[model samples]
Target chain A: MGINSVTTMSPGVGAKLRRMHPLPIRIMHWVNAVAMFIMIGSGWKIYNDEVIFGWLHFPEFLTIGKWAQHGLQWHFLGMWIIFFNGLAYLTYGFATGRFRRMLLPIAWRDVVATIKDSLRLKLSHDDETKYNAVQKLLYIGVLLAGVMIVLSGMAIWKPVQFSELYFLFGDFQTARLIHFFCMAAIVGFVIVHIALAILVPKTLVAMVAGGPIVSDADQSGARHMNETGNHP
Target chain B: MSKPPSRSIFRPSGKIDSSILQADPKLLYEIDRRKVIRGAVSLGALSFLTGCNVSEVDQVQSALRAVSTWNDLAQSVIFRPNHLAPTYPESRVVKPPRFNAHYNIEDVQPVDVNGWKLELSGLIADKRPWRASDIYALPEQEMIIKHICIEGWDYIGQWSGVNLKTFLERIGADLSAKYVAFKCADDYTESLDMASALHPQTMLATKYAKELMADPFGFPLRLRTATKIGFKNAKWITALEVTNNRPQTYYEKEGFNWFSGM
Candidate 1:
């Protein structure tokens, strides 16, 4: 979603909140963060069972549940939490039109310029409420990767029941490889995400509170209101 | 907190000679401390050099293997040997049923069905070789079921065969034995739990797609079931053994799950 995504709270023209993320969004964001870490840590331990390349391991210190049995327990627990949380988040986002409105006008052409600007560390403090092209791309990429990871995970866990997904992943070991790489990419993205959050502390605070402490630039900028209001 | 005297000890300065140690108690104390420190370091090295000490790698590997063993036991408990695999409609069957083996496709040689006889051994009451005619006369059934592979693909195929449970009974096999092993002509060995061997879906498949099996399809006879992966199917059957000790299959020795019950 882009800057145009809906916040749905209309507290008159000059309200206290500056029309930032709503409370549910912030709460879900924290839940997702914790879930992701658990999944990754346990997944690394499981991967250590059969090292993919030449005895390489993620190191016992860096992983959760160094033992296979205990690691799988942690993994399954994380999987359920993430799966259900994602389901609820997706359902609410699409139903309220927040997903589309928040991520709108994200053109593919702006990608290269955004990358260049990010490399140079060039940014506008005023655009904190709005998403830059690079931020939008990263968010969208993570969302897509999340879906792929889930599907590949299911295929590996239950190949017979979900035969089509198994085939899509190009076989069992191939799916495992995809799953492992997807985890690594997401981990990298999260590190960058945290660093960026540190750079822009205001955004982090807003996410924590789920309300804009700053000013809403536009009167009717959010598309969420229109999308839901029109549906009724 | 830098002390010039402490730094001079390792520097081998002649300022602290044997006569100076007797004259000054501080120098004697410092020399004794150094002796204790050196002893500790030497003891640490000796312990490591002895080779009886446990290593970090060994501990972690054992921990993981222990967990794997626990997983195997847990999986075995949940296994429902009596459960039947779901059947599908004839229209849903996948065509050109997948050909799989440890070797290349061209390397598969054809067996002479004319002189072929299904061998029997182990705890079986009847060790006589049965000709194709004898096997064909047994009561058979047909099923259209999905066959999943360990490599991550599946295909629906029509398999016609005599029910393994019935065949085992007809051959007077020791049903209570721990394992039912298939020793294939292809040199591939596969085994199943006595319960899995008696599963309703488990069969000694005689025909595929309503036709006699050819070279690629495990001609003459094949093992068919949806309970296990494709590699465990054990094609081109030559001998069947009923044994108390479960024999590990060719793939199982390669670190694949033994039960492998999907």
Candidate 2:
């Protein structure tokens, strides 16, 4: 979708928007969504040291023995999925030059203006922009944190082969500490992202439907060209 | 023109297919409900089915077995060209190193050199016994190696002993034998796969860190498996059995992975 197509629509008249997200992007988004849930679930199972599947008739003390090993195998396999998905998304974004659209420094003036507008509770009515500077920065931070998590994970996984990396991280124990902290940070960001979606329902709708769920009353709030939506 | 159904009418547009919208709203709602119920039911069924055959503990036990299986699988796939752990320079040795397990090997009663008989049985045509000096007579291999414990910490030390494979070759193990189970003086016991047992680097150490091994360290006899984890290197060695069957180590019987190695 072209940038101009996003803004030229008229206001004050309800008109359905055509597709906003390209098909490939939508597919990647959904796959990533499903894969993430599985990774988190299996990951939890692996982390719970005392949790042993005891339903099968077995003596005590044996539960931790096998459950922990297999859980790691599954976790590593899921990791590869996340790695490939991130690689594809990054490659596509860079190739299309849309990477900058997701995160580019807005003028400092724009950031200050947006913050002021938000504090004034005018954010709901504020001319909807794709992503504010603060939002872009947050996204970039999350992306970089993911890379750090993967790198630290690798250092711990093969400390011998990645001896230099292991030494740099101050050995396996230290690397594990950093990896865990990064995971917590990522989870915290996810919680905030979901909260904002609820606060701004239109953004969530836009993501799923590839168009704003423009109400009849708000049609006037948008630009005039959006009335029929044909202009967009 | 008939206004498209108002946004208030619950019509979602764009990427959501129109056919989904065209379906009767009640049917759609019912389908969604059915989907939720079916999903829950399937999940419950899976849990129950798996539960019927395997308890939570059984899965854990399976995982323990998998650790050993994964080790074996790794060995089969990733052939180590060198099959050797790195040899550190003598200067790198940690002097007066803090030792953990088997540090006080002298505490145990010394095995009578003459009475001590190394039993070779299981997947073999005949059982044989070797005197203490007989094993000592073999070419002594001296090298520094790490004893990495599962709990986490590791210590580098010198090991002076003969290759267990050399002993295996001398005895002439039966073709069926695939593992060597070390029955030790203490309650502790361990088993090694044939490839690991036969690995040229594996040794039966009589000395630790270049000193005569204290009794607690299995003086005059101890299994030193360089390729395997520390647990497999049993102290106070008493008997060595060749076996086709998967030998039961005390830990392995308790669900620890048999092959605990890199």
Candidate 3:
């Protein structure tokens, strides 16, 4: 029933039970994923109705809504979900120090090394719990893009009520352009994220089922442990 | 000559004839082909993967509609009565503002400005009709504001008319009423919340760019509010009503947000 009893009975089972992705983090991740999918698909449909560029248009198959009006409805629905869900994710990340632990301390040397290894197809995924410099950078960039998309969306949605936001983005039309570019950034991030996850399938498994529970001490000594192949 | 009945593209009441499908197999095949393609790629596949049926799709639609209604309420709550939409300089105003209507431009039936009367009704102390001259004689206010369309395009225009609040006050409208509805000569209907109707920048615009409104535009009068989307500014004004009951507007019935405040 207790942790000590479980550890005494089966140490491997006990360690595996402690997850890399905590329950809240997993839930938030999946929820945010669904919300983002809805927002992007419906947004593309809305964009297609009155395209900013004369030539560019999202194909019908890639879009969500049946028509422009239906797209607007789906967009508003997704907007509320993303707004509240994103707020919750941010609060959870900051409150629990998850962001600090997982994404911080990205040195220039680490980034350069990671890029070099990545280009050579030699970047290690031995420690599922640790994020490389490139991953951290991408995550941080996407987070900022998420924030901008919401703000720019609000500016476009209620330009008069949020006149300050409208002015911040230059104007209604400019705000739309900002929102569109933010979406593009997010979409680009998603493509790379998915491609990397597929390349290292264990990372995807770690996110879904949580690969392993690495303690703070183990995480600190992960590199030394990987080199030594130590069980304990 | 008797005038033909006006057909609303928004509210299509007639059922499609099945005979047409039988008569043209090619057309039917085309329809089926598109449906199959859509099903293979879009939400249809999603619904199938999730084991969701038509009723579940309806449930999702209803849920989204509920959120939209809540959004309307939320927007009204956040709407500042005194916050003015940013005004542009004269140079920014788009000359001959882009024309938009449910129908094509050639089909526009220009209202007879000489015979046009602003009819009033519903919860107003004054239910009298006034000629176009009466509205033109009233004290006027001008605004150079952006006209944002629901479809994501926007343009700047100069509009001048009696402030809607001033007009409603003059007509003795019940200020506490829930909605101020409009009926256009073109048979397009629109409504505004009482708060939006009373907003300082809302007006029954009579002129554009210091000139009398062109026939292609609303010839005699049109609703012009800085806060709401362009479609909410119904053109070719014919009647105004203040009422507690919500009036369904043209696009609102077609699933556009009713309180499309921007």
Q: For chain B alone, what TM-score does every candidate structure achieve against the true structure?
A: 0.75, 0.71, 0.78
- Candidate 3, which CAPRI tier? medium
Best by DockQ: 3
TM-score of 1: 0.52
> On residues A1-232, what C-alpha lDDT tens digit does candidate 3 reach at each position?
4555444444343233246678788888899899999899999999998999999999999999888888999899889889998999999889866787788878889999999999998958887678888888999999999999999999999888998888899988889999999999999999998998899998888788855664432333232222222333
Candidate 2's fnat? 0.00
> Best to worst by TM-score, what's the order?
3, 2, 1
All DockQ scores: 0.08, 0.06, 0.69
Q: Any runs in candidate 2 off by more than 4 Å, and if so which?
A: A1-148, A151-155, A159-232, B1-44, B47-76, B79-83, B94-115, B123-127, B174-178, B198-200, B253-255
Model 1: lDDT equals 0.74
TM-score of each: 0.52, 0.60, 0.83
User: DockQ ranking from best to worst?
Assistant: 3, 1, 2
lDDT (10s digit) by residue, model 1, range B1-262: 7756546446764554677556888766666777899998987785566433344455443444444546556556756766566678998876668888878889998878898889988988878898878888899889998786654456789999899999999889989888899888878899987877898888999898888877888988989977776777888899888999867679765545566666
Model 3 residue pairs with clashes: none
Question: What are the iRMS values of all candidates?
Answer: 6.5, 5.2, 0.8
Rank by lDDT, highest first: 3, 1, 2
- The Cα RMSD of model 3 versus the native structure comes to 14.7
Per-residue error at A64 for model 3, in Å? Answer: 0.9
For candidate 3 chain A, the 10 contiguous residues with the lowest summed lDDT are A221-230
Residue lDDT tens for model 2, A83-184: 788788778877854556446655788778878877887655343435776677677888887778778876655454345565679755567667767766
